[model samples]
Target: MSEHHEHRHPHGHEEHTQDVRAHRGHGPGRRFARWRHRLRHAVTPHTHDSSDKVDGALESSARGMRALWVSLAVLGVTAAAQAGIVVLSGSVALLGDTVHNAADALTAVPLGVAFVLGRRAASRRFTYGYGRAEDLAGIVIVLTIAASAVFAGWTAVNRLLDPRDMDHVGVVAAAAVVGFLGNEWVARYRIRVGRRIGSAALVADGLHARTDGFTSLAVLLSAAGAAIGWRYADPIVGLLITAAILLVLRDAAGEVFRRVMDAVDPALLGRAEDALRRVRGVREVGELRMRWIGHRLRAEVALVVDADLTVRQAHDIAVDAEHALLHAVPKLTAALVHADPAPAADGPDPHLALAHHMTA
Candidate 1:
């Protein structure tokens, strides 16, 4: 996603405070204004160029696409190898793995496209940019992995209920070894690229590759067990592998769904709240709300500052609060700091007092 940053100057901090007062908008705009105000005052102009960031993201995206191609190729080769082993060994579990490998290949195409799209800029209508595409692609990958696991588990259950004679275990074991090595290579490369680009889609692709390696290891052990005279061991090992896949699926599904629904990470919210509370003039944080807009975190924070301070002082404190939240929580893209005056010498403001009582 594209990130916007404003110039900050210490002497012009007062001007920024006035501009924030003139802004009257919803949570998004107010949050943007708060960030702009703080950023416009806290730091001076820089001489360093930003072309490196753009180049790095693009290079990462390209690497992810290349890794996807390699994964796809390996999947096809592994699937063919498994098919040959299944035919020679007459093993239902091996046949199921063949199908799973083929399915993994199918997912690589869309995931590659998603990674590329995630690098693009946002249009006027799509202000958040294309980061959500990566999240959506991750969801698709998780679903496919879940389906493969369930299907493999079902096949293993049926095979366990009805025993069959399996042969050529050595061939199946050799194929599984090859698949494991291939998957390892893809997983390592894709994971590095994903982290570099900060692309969830590429990360999901890497996870899929790692899963393939585990699946291969399980299948290899099962083949060896079948050769060693424990006919039931093959299906048992297959079931165990399937169970592992299901566990990964559960976590991936929950994370992707949360992102899609704009859910805020609890740890991030807690950090933001803590930082704002620690600001110089802030007495407490009230009405704290936060969510994910694309890959960026946005927050709305209502805070109580000293009423004795001037408006400019309160605004400066609010700016500090916003800065604290953003700096303390790296993922927080924007924050809206609403400065509430504390109680007067005689008593609290009547409206604030009534609102506090109602809230309490």
Candidate 2:
């Protein structure tokens, strides 16, 4: 067993050193172009592993916190503005949107707590640290969305049974616009950062915000129908908003469920296997597995090497394979590489006894 725990900083340093050497012979124009390229990658989300300027996990947590705080503030203000309109217009649609916005804003609290907990150092009792807190926060968010939907549906049904004329239709429309603008901005911010850091929780929150925005637009439509003397328009749109919430709830729930189940993208497994197979002296790559602990990744891989090689040689090959993986797989912080001897063609299978014992 040749285990290696790698972080982004060392690889970043190596890349920087190489960049400096490469730039020495190149013109300033080339250097500038390379700088722009790195900047683009830094700002945008992608699958390739690249050198990061800071510690990947910590920096990602920090970014997640920042996103939560900003989104919370924006949604808080938007909901407050809508709340006043709801009181004046007595529009069930506006009321439902406002309530949902408030709930969405409150979701930031749990996610912020999770991000903080994730930064704690690993302890003896919990060797993997508290990264799973983010997934828990995601569950909380999903439940919150569901609760909002239920409340909205109940209120809308009550209003539908007993229709009431709404006031301040124009004002409600303006408030709806405000809600749309605020939520759309928050959605873009949270989703971009979430994808960059690989945080499913944050991305779920972003999707929630996006649906809220569209529901807000539905409020505008409700106001228009109310102006045209349609008695049921307000409650009707409220029900529609509730249905939209349920749809987003499904998506967010699915994402959080996958994270909780330790599911990862199949492409990442392929990338890891390819990286391992490309390593020198590796005859075969076997039993490669990857899992997400929060937004970061860890891997375990088995390698087959020549049976005649010395233990030291085998160890070196494993180390090389691990290094290759660190560079090839994005967000991979650690890998455990186990080397096995290639079995002789006519001899008894070396792993058969161990495998049988394990099964037994």
Candidate 3:
């Protein structure tokens, strides 16, 4: 990726850096963009387009990758700043928050890998390509969130059992504010982009960041309380932060579990039905099935057609329905349309006996 980016600018080195940085974002952002370019180069294992059908899905993955990279940089800087405060102030609460920020930064690693893997072409052994890896990445993120909650709770309990002195109250307070501002900014940016791209995992990560911002506020309160000569406030605030983390954990776990079980929005099904009905020859839509493969949707639709229509005619109708569905449904990669003959009052049910969904 770095090599590719470098080749885009063959002019004078100084002017090239300034142009690329301006194109990316902030004027002085060239250094950071260059850093991200190098980081992108390190993680992207292989590059291949799955198919023209998945181009939209691939674009979503690309947006997700960019979000993860930017968030990682923000959180890393936030955690490092807090760590310096923790060392000088000897504040247990600030230390816990710093640890969590670090963990949140690392969670981006798996998601970044998943996005790269999703771009690979489908293989004989894995006909769906590597998109499911994003779901796996979601699982890793949920587990990471859970582990952070547990660690934070344990640390708070230990601190409560043996209270310790805290120094540099003003500095601790300043660091807490910095942490909160950084996380809140990241949370809003990630959630906004995630919704636009239809990525549940990225949205969950955004919620996670929002919760972390609240925890940082709790640390700020601890700093204030300690300055007022309240020794127990540090442990109490730490416990509150732990509770906040647990709340975030519950929501994140639910979303990850839903994706793992292949749950999808009912509204998406309605759109699929609407699309199929638009086809001229479809008599009655039936037994439609849909699932999310990562952020992408795939569907199998069954519908009734005129009993007098020949087999070729039914196939053509199915093809037209498939095309309609692909256009109507958001992020739909493939639609398997199975046409059935109109109901017959006589004899056995041949509809169930015949093989359906023949793809070229």
Candidate 4:
């Protein structure tokens, strides 16, 4: 089978650089292209350009980064407020919750770094790009959650054995409300951006913050228990928060582990196939592969076209296939479309595809 290939990525669209000269032009169009070309490369940290596929990837990553920084600011302020309450109340439950909030605020650091790294251009050694850094950040987030769980659990156990009087109960309750509001706001923003950007790691981070907000509410319960003369209530709530943290750990760990293993949503593959079939000259969809490289998605596909098509014609088909996938698949930053020659009309169909196959 004769194969012609086309590719695309981060800031621009490329039909295929099958012919090097096809990419170079003269006059005003060339000047405009040059500016956009420079902008795409300059904006993206990674060199995984489909020649210059500056579309949604650049905008999406930028949005993810903005969300991280904003969330960091909001959470930091919330943690500071809670810290003041912890100092005044001497409530260990509030202290544990405060610590978790601080850690949640700090998690934005790793996530932000991941976003920055993910923007770097792709190189020969890392053809898929540095998008995997976000997944690594997700690992850090999961570990932080686990650490918070252990710390909270230990404090709860210690207090269970030796209960202490909690002061400034009213102040602690008010602080808990502040923590909840702040964290919930950050959580919503993070999750919204993460989902829009197709970043599993960011989504996990948001969930972590949401969990912290719930723990903050638990601090409120601890204060109520103290008011009611239930000496064990504060520590019990702490222990419960620990259990909740563990549950969140399970979820975040599963998400990160799956991404580390390069697992993607099944629906994505279906969309890729549908997109390939929609192309005018794609006879049969052979093999389609997709994976998340950080928050951006990259795809590779094998497409069958009529055997008699010229190399140039096959290249055009591949170009169309790539363009279709880019438009149809969500969050897809790059794609490699390989056009394979189908069996001649008289020969037996080896791939045995359905009757919907296209003809030359």
TM-scores for every candidate against the unseen true structure: 0.67, 0.83, 0.80, 0.81
**What value of lDDT does candidate 3 attain over all alpha carbons?**
0.74
Instruction: Tell me the deviation in Å of residue 299 in model 3.
Output: 0.6
lDDT of each: 0.67, 0.78, 0.74, 0.78
Query: Which 10 successive residues of model 3 have the least lDDT summed?
Result: 1-10
All candidates: CA RMSD (Å): 8.7, 7.1, 14.7, 7.7
lDDT digits (tens) for residues 185-236 of candidate 3: 9989888887776667777788788777877888788888888898788778
Clashes of each: 1, 0, 0, 19
Give residue 132's lDDT in candidate 4 (0 to 100). 88
The candidate that wins on TM-score is 2
Q: Write the per-residue lDDT of candidate 4 for residues 287-346, one digit (tens) a residue.
A: 888888887777889888888878877887776677667657767766888777787769
Pairs of colliding residues, candidate 1: 8-40
Which runs in model 4 stand beyond 4 Å of their true positions? 9-56, 344-360
Residue 10, candidate 2: Cα error in Å is: 5.3
What TM-score number comes out for model 4? 0.81
Better of 3 and 4 by lDDT: 4
